[model samples]
Target: MSYHNPVLLQESIDALAIKEDGVYVDVTFGGGGHSREILKRLGPNGRLFAFDQDPDALENEIEDERFTLIPENFRFISRFLRFHRIKKVDGILADLGVSSHQFDEAERGFSIRFDGDLDMRMNQKSKVSAKEIINSYSEEKLAEILFLYGELRNSRNIAKTIVESREGERIETSFQLKQVLQKYLPKAKEHKILAQIFQAVRIEVNEELDVLREFLQQMPNLLKEEGRLSVISYHSLEDRLVKRFIRTGLFSGEPEKDVFGNSDVPLQKVGKLIVPTPQEIKINNRARSAKLRIATLKV
Candidate 1:
């Protein structure tokens, strides 16, 4: 199966306002779909640097002189770019969240549809995995992950159940986890609820929130003056951080004013938030929850 189908392709590419001779970065090159599009718009003088933490994505790397593929987490994007001797870029694009390929591959344990091992590390090299999170984390920690990341209403009860059930037997696989939480599963739309559970586990296992904060902090430093940043987030938690950072240069609250009473926001919102069109979502259901936001550096 294909690795992924890039969501909001045209919308995201257009948002970048690509310059033919400019440098660009695709922070999440899941399937190389977005990278290919960016490359097509670049002139021979232009360069494209793509980053993906998952080693699986490196298999799809395109052999182009103008393009460089970095198999590293995007949280270290700035450091990697500097190592390559590129100080700043004209534009940057990030399509956050799990790739369809990851979810579709049963072995990856990113989806609730398939019964597989609960190992949801985007970077397989990472020490942590979903199994560790489910079995090792305390009830309080588990409840917090489900409540904050999954936004599940019955997080406390679900966490309690998981803790009680895994007292003796180890919960290792997706099926086992699902069976343990069967009682909490919604009757009419059980799949959706299960998905949320899996999502929460995946987020915690990967430390996604922390990575997003690190990546966003590096964006202002990576982009040149007036350079554009187009980010597509699939969940409210991710979107809220992106929105807050872009609006106030802070992740959660207003920017602190200097002694001169001037705020130091590094980015300026380019336009209102953009979402996939009905037509686009009709073809790709994964695009339904996507929210795209564009920002430009203040110089």
Candidate 2:
């Protein structure tokens, strides 16, 4: 019922530049907050499709005939949308990262504040969970996830600590993992460091970065000419990928150019990056790290 207020709600919807009778997709309909707003802007003929892999999120489905909620991951956006007889949408909006509801439900095991099970599967049926990553992953692999996803510099030491500690007792819960890596979490930066560690494991369990990359790669072909894409990402990793793809049409390296020196990039940015105002952050702390980037199919 009370999912975190969708981060950058007004700004994100506005970025879509909605048309009264156009088709659109909300690829991360966690709470249906943005989907609701898009509906408000649509006329009788306008249609909106949404995607959410989490079983819990399906409970918040909208009843409107104009809206359809697809219970699948956005990484498969192309396949599912085609099933609905949709080829191109006028716009696509994505609110990336974990939702507040996921964090609040201690049983879901997303928050470090709660001493819950170490399961952080966005999709309840997911085979991998944070528990498996933390308790069963190789030390080298764990270090790689922590360093790359969490951006922790001392990842090797953290991985070593986890491997050593798990040898005595299996780390099955959030608090257990925290206790095992106690030395890495100093008093001043404990929360931040722990959050990063959790983030890394969660990302690995969910394959978040890979999912984002797949979703973005489909955008160029998914949207109609001049169709808009509005994405709100909560961290640097996601933001960087979105920024780079919109610029180069490729996740990494420079876009190849023709002999005439014109690079064939698919999307052009619509505006400067948008972030929450201090006022918005004051109202919802979750909005603090949100960054919005808007883009449209290049002419």
Error of 1 at 284 (Å): 0.8
Model 2 clashing residue pairs (backbone): none
Candidate 2 Cα outliers beyond 4 Å, as residue runs: none
Error of 2 at 214 (Å): 0.5
Per-candidate TM-scores read: 0.97, 0.99
Instruction: Please give the CA lDDT of all the candidate structures.
Output: 0.91, 0.93
lDDT of 1 by residue, 54-134 (tens): 988999999999999999999889889999999999999999969999989999988888998999999999999999999
Please provide, for model 2 over 12-95, each residue's C-alpha lDDT reduced to its tens digit, 9 standing for 90 to 100.
999999999999999999989999999999999999999999998999999999999999999999899999999999999999
Model 1 TM? 0.97
